[model samples]
Target: MKKFHRDASTLVLTLISVLLLTVSALICLKALGPHGEPMPSVTDWISAVGQAVGALLTGGALIYAARTYSKQRQDRHEELEQKRQEQAGKIIVRVKHGLPDDRTSVSLTNPTNLPIFKMNLYTIDDDGQVIEGQPLSEEVVVGDYPGHAYTQRYRVHSAYAVFTDSGGVAWIRTSKGTLFE
Candidate 1:
């Protein structure tokens, strides 16, 4: 689709160039008429109308090119933002050894430099079932710098854990590895 738009814009630019050249040639011919005599009034008027039409066509083509360029820039920006989000979503949590009742807490370190706000935690049972956890007494705010970790002690037991950030991006971790969604 991008290639198609580029090709179409190129074609329009070429047509505009041709139209301009034609109008210029007509004006030159009128200025250097045969035997120094200008063409009839009717022919001069027709040429003037043609020049006006050519100018309008060139203006339209330029507007189209500007719009196409703007759209392409916007699309590129959106694509970059999506990729940044995917990278930002890679928050990892390491659960310390011990059972949920052992006073051990799950620790999350934000490797990213951007702070994470309003983060939430959930759990997965041995049966691969998700159990929604209760909200923290205070909102979870994780700083972006490395070595910045947040740990929460669980009141209940679960085999696996899931962490979600303010952006609604979630990551699941177990003994196996981390899974992102």
Candidate 2:
């Protein structure tokens, strides 16, 4: 795994270096002489460098866009695996109808001896729309998780736990703790 990361990083760095060299060459070619038929000025070099930087940025953007397709596929795969794991029964607790906007608390457990990132619970409304933080009053965190991506830390739970006093109001008493509105 370490070797894979090292190789990926090296490949990225090499690609970036090649991109920089190509952009620099193009900039130099375009700015061979001064503009407006006058000898090149100090500003010309600056402009050339700026153009090269712009080209580099454009190339990076293109690369990122190209990678997005693969990223989406990987994300879907991870999500499926997570759902299957959840179905297999992860230690989780929930507190429903605890805020004004029907806010709920869904606590998840990482029992696979691994810590996950971007672990957010998605709830669907009755109208079939994803409720964002529009009616959220304030977000609070009662705990933190500091485990590695592949390490289990039950004590350090609540990976991305957030509490926003939404529209629905209620009280909850879980085996872990009690949350009130």
lDDT of 1 by residue, 1-181 (tens): 8567666776776677667767766675664466757555776767766766776677667667756776786689789768656644556644454544454444455665555554554444335554344322124445521211122423333433355545556545442445555
- Which candidate number would show the highest lDDT if scored against the true structure? 1
Residue 170, model 2, lDDT: 30
**Prediction-by-prediction clash tally:** 0, 11
What lDDT does the true structure give each of the candidates?
0.53, 0.44
lDDT of 1: 0.53
Which 10-residue window in model 1 sums to the lowest lDDT?
144-153
**Cα-based RMSD of candidate 2:** 18.7
lDDT of 2 by residue, 123-143 (tens): 334454434432222232223
Clashing pairs in 1: none
